[model samples]
Target: MTATERPDVRPANPHFSSGPCAKRPGWTVKNLENALVGRSHRSKPGKARLVEAIEKTRSVLGVPADYRIGIVPASDTGAVEMALWSMLGARGVDMLAWESFGEGWVTDVVKQLKLKDARILKAPYGELPNLADVNFDNDVVFTWNGTTSGVRVPNGNWIADDRKGLTICDATSAAFAQDLAWPKLDVVTFSWQKVLGGEAAHGVLILSPRAVERLESYTPAWPMPKIFRMTKGGKLNEGIFKGETINTPSMICVEDYLDALNWADSIGGLKSLIGRADANTAVIAEWVGRTPWADFLAKELDTRSNTSVCLKIVDERVTALSEEDQVAFAKKIADLLDKEGVANDIAGYRDAPAGLRIWAGATVETTDMRALMPWLDWAFAEAIASLKAAA
Candidate 1:
């Protein structure tokens, strides 16, 4: 394709960002007009909004009735650290990492916490760690989807139903779009910025009956920060799960989340949301099937992520270059697309393998994804030609 052979159709919205993702299709600040911004989050109206967000999340995700869900500070990272700090020292632990965020957790557990009885399971940027080797007798921590790698756990089939220890999952990229195995999972954390396409700096923590029991039973020797505390005396902090956050929350962000939740409901809730994401991915999959230079970073079809779809450039001209040159070439393609108003913030993460990572969550329209395909083809060809000219 030549540089001038631009596709006639364009994505109506060029917001394929993975985090703080594309907002609800028709979102407007006016939707959050009654945000209770001036009121304290502890006030009845503000608390009611927070509770509504939690209850709506519970309903949309089909979380177990007995599970406890809470709004927490510092987004998904905060919620995950809170769980790790509070519950890990009780027993031996297994940590799995395949991508940037997962690796961050690994760093925290190994370097910062300095736990004695910890096993690390690792994989490269585009693959998943071996799940079959995981020890269910010990607590297990993993991400439901590696946002940077675009590789996700195929399903919860690998998890043991009767495991003695708990499963702590960072499902920041999977919550509303993926089917979480609630019974097998003990603790789950996700941010509002991903699939819901809402505000950032806020996280939701979901815990099962087993997890709540752990909170009641175990106590870490380390000094737990106030933001990470989820227990009072010897029992669970029931109020936190009931909209009593451990710290102050942004009421406007809470309202934004509520608006996204209502949008999910109007679109048929969880099943429909998952379907939309699946369809968006299917579009890219179809495009990749015929595109010679591009392929999914995830080697296994089953593990291919339907949300953050990481793609590698395999065109010989590009791959023939050194790794540094390959990165620069990929950046050119991404930059050209951005300049053309074709897509925004679609670059692969700093820690991820050199490639393009596009967001394919529920908020993204299928038509837009289809439109973006031709542009991707154009960008690759154009970038390669320019790279050769420079060479």
Candidate 2:
């Protein structure tokens, strides 16, 4: 079917932006009418809603019974920094870097925390550092999925069953779209704007029992920031995980997030959500198979990401143009898609070279993606021909 002929053609459905991804199916402002707008977050009703959001997320995500879930400030970055500042100094650290976010953490470790004995296992984008080479005995930090490069760890089997270190994971992009092995992770952090498609500004922190023990017993050598302090006087502040946030939160945003969680439940939870992501990505995978100019940015099929599917144009005809010209041509096609409203925000990440990055998260409908693919081919052909004529 032509892209214009498809009935499911929504400018919103085939959005495919990396973060603040497309909203949940049937999401609307009317769904959040009773968010206690005028009341304080410290009020009884507001606190109750906060607690419900945490508990429901735990149930929906299949977090272990022993884990504690909390809402934190600054979204995913805040949640991760809280764990790092509160727990890292007590043990040696092994920082893993495979993409932009991982490299951001490495910068935080060296420049921000100034940890003297940390070891970094680094790899180029689209590849993972050797998981087996990591020393689990040291506190470990990693991104479960590299959203920018569209690569993800195949599984969590490399984590030792009885390692002494705490595994801190930034799972902002992987939360609802992939199965998380809670037993293999100690501290996990994610933002509402990711898979859930809720508004940004808040983060969720899931702490395994071991992570709590570390927080209660060991303090970092550096002074604690007010937001990062999870314990006081060497004792865990259990209330923080219950509903008592470190600071105020947007009740409206909380209500919206709860709505997202409820929608997640309605769709048969994570398994079904994963199925949607897989199906949406499969549409792109099939397109890649037939298009001569297109290839996956991910090096290996097994490591290829189902959520953020990035593509590189490899056609020699396009490559015949100067490098700068090729990139400009690619940008022009992306702009055309955006202008026609056939797709929105599918440009590659800034750090990466010219290409397209499409988010196939659960919120995206596969039927819409199927309709959108042909339009991409048409736009690319038109843009390349124009560039050649100009040259």
Candidate 3:
């Protein structure tokens, strides 16, 4: 096939960005008609809506009975910052980095807080640090999924069951689509706009009993911002966990999340969500297996993320070019797909190595994924022909 030849079919829905990802199949603005737009989030009805979101999340994800789940301000970043700022000083900390977001957290711990006892465990993109070497005696901070690199920890088995310190996980991209080991994680944070495909700017913060205990006992050396404050007068602010937000929230976003959660429940909850994502990833994996030009960025099968499936161009014609040309080549393919309206926002993250990043979360239909495969092939062939013509 040449640049002039195109695929016969295009993805039914082309909203495949890794964040603010594709909405649940059949999602519509009309579904959000009941959003409490004019009402205060703290109002009786509004808080009930918020509580419903929380309880439904717990019920769907199987979060423990003892864990406290709260709707926090900002996205996953805010939830992570709250945990890092409020919980790290009490013990030595180990920070892990394999991708952009993980590197950002490393900067927060080492540069922002300037924790003297911080130990950094890092790996190049597409790889994971040695999980067995992690020091459980020190509070550990890591991303459950490396969104930029499409890598993830295989499971929570590496985390010690009886660790002395907390495990704070930034799980924005992993929630719903992946199984999170709740007991192994003391503090886990995710945003509404990730796998569930809800609106952005709101984060969910889940805390185990151990995490709450740390909040009650340990205070950070730096001053806590109003939004990061989870405790008051040395006791956990129980209301936050019960739908009383620390700051005003957008009721519309809340309503959107509620709709997504209800959709998740209706579709057989977490098991179905995971199966859908797995099926979507399998579509890409099979395509990559047969395609000569592409390969997964993740080095290992177990570590590859089902949500953010990153791929690198391996065609010698492209890889033989200068680094800048390689990036341009990858961008050309992404642009071609976008222009064809078969895919959108499929380019690799800016800081990540130049490649393709597809969101194969539960919300994205596998049929759409199967349809998008040929478009990718067409786009790559078009890019290669353009490259030859330019030469």
Ranking by lDDT: 3, 1, 2
Candidate 2 lDDT trough over 10 residues, lowest sum: 2-11
Q: Write the per-residue lDDT of candidate 3 for residues 1-391, one digit (tens) a residue.
A: 4435777877899988999999888899999999998888888999999999999999999999999999999999999999999999999999999999999999988899999999999999999999988999999999999999999999999999989999999999999999999889999999989999999999999999999999999888898889899998999999999999989998989989999999999999999999999999999999999989999999999999999999999988988999888888889989988887889999999999889999999999998999999888888888888888988
Q: Which regions of candidate 2 are displaced past 4 Å?
A: 1-14, 320-326
Give the TM-score (vs. native) of candidate 3. 0.99
| Residue 151, model 1: Cα distance from true site in angstroms | 0.5
For model 1, residues 315-354, the per-residue Cα lDDT tens digits are: 8888888988888888888898899999998988887778
Q: How close is candidate 2 to the true structure, as a TM-score?
A: 0.95
- Every candidate's lDDT: 0.92, 0.87, 0.93
Worst 10 residues of 1 by lDDT: 1-10
- Itemize residue pairs with steric clashes in candidate 2: none
Clashes of 3: 0
TM-score of each: 0.98, 0.95, 0.99
